[model samples]
Target: MKHWRGAVALTISSALVTGPAVQVRANPTAVPAVAVCVASVGCVVTVVAIAGVTYWVLSNNGQELRIPVLSYTPTPDQQLEDWEDYVWADNEQQARRKCNLLAEQYTNQGGSLVTVVRVRRASQRGSRWACTFRG
Candidate 1:
């Protein structure tokens, strides 16, 4: 009786371990549907994430215009101090509009005599050059 029980257990365990192997051997080209679907979804998500990052890196989304302002001091010995204001916009016109808004805000806040020296547009590769304000 003991030998018979051991033989039965061995047969069941071997069948359980080799069942999938036998099926693969019978039809080697058959792929499971669930694996294919999961793989396809993973690939799609990866491709979309890569494309979005590439677009953001290659585009001029975060480009800014640097406006240099010379502030005059109201003291016995008047001094002129220079500062920069950065505005992010799509183009030069939009940047000028934003700069005008900033100038209004600054003037309303009791700021000193501020005069804009020039507008500098920063390139995507970090170089900056003078850009004319059309506003």
Candidate 2:
């Protein structure tokens, strides 16, 4: 009886010492949903902003004019909400030539011309722009 008890104790000890193990299987298509979600949110926000601005411009201006909207992706070094005009040509002749016709039309209407030239360099980051005029 004592021998039998000793054998049972040894078996239990060995089982306890070995411990239980778990295996985790990897999912092959486990792409992080965070980026997708954030991008979707950004797109929605961009659309809403564009729509709201369009409505405001139409309501405020007696004459509706064409407005250009530019959109691009951001670079790694840039923060999410950071936005700025990255380039402009200071050459007076070139600037005037490029914007000459528009300036003339607005000036003819007894409104002063305000020229805003903005340029952005190569980037993989995301951004958007809208331009409108009212007097």
Candidate 3:
């Protein structure tokens, strides 16, 4: 708008300079009619320009930019809950079978069977299996 203001100033300066009523004012007491007409026209133009600028500014001020919302769903591995389950098998063969069954269960629940080992139960007479899983 600096260029626009320059144009406005140029217009007003030209109007003041070119107004023929200045030459008609040969007597000191005479009022120049053409100069009043030019000045009034320039004032009207300035008022209109100011009004146009105010309208443009006000019309653009309230415009708002809206960004879309984003949503994410986790993968099966990430969706899996924490591991906290067990399996008990009496013999080695049964322990292996139970371990496989537990592995299947873990996979169904979105988990990975990381480790399974035989451990002796302190209060029991036989050996048992301990399984660990992760997701």
**Candidate 3 on 66-133: residue-level lDDT in tens?**
21111123353554322434457677577667766776776677544333433333235555555544
lDDT of 2 by residue, 66-100 (tens): 22222222344532231232222344444344344
Could you tell which candidate, 1 or 3, scores higher by TM-score?
Answer: 1
**What is the alpha-carbon lDDT for the whole of candidate 2?**
0.27
Model 1, 39-117: lDDT tens digits are 3422210000121121001112343222111112245465444456777766767766666666666656745545455
Look at candidate 1 and give me any clashing residue pairs: none
Backbone clash pairs in model 3 (N, Cα, C under 3 Å; residues 3+ apart or in different chains), count: 0
TM per candidate comes to 0.33, 0.17, 0.28
Per-candidate clashes, comma-separated: 0, 6, 0
Higher lDDT: candidate 2 or 3?
3
The order by descending TM-score is: 1, 3, 2
Off by over 4 Å in 3: 1-84, 111-123
Error of 2 at 25 (Å): 57
Poorest 10 consecutive residues of model 2 by lDDT? 1-10
lDDT of 1: 0.34
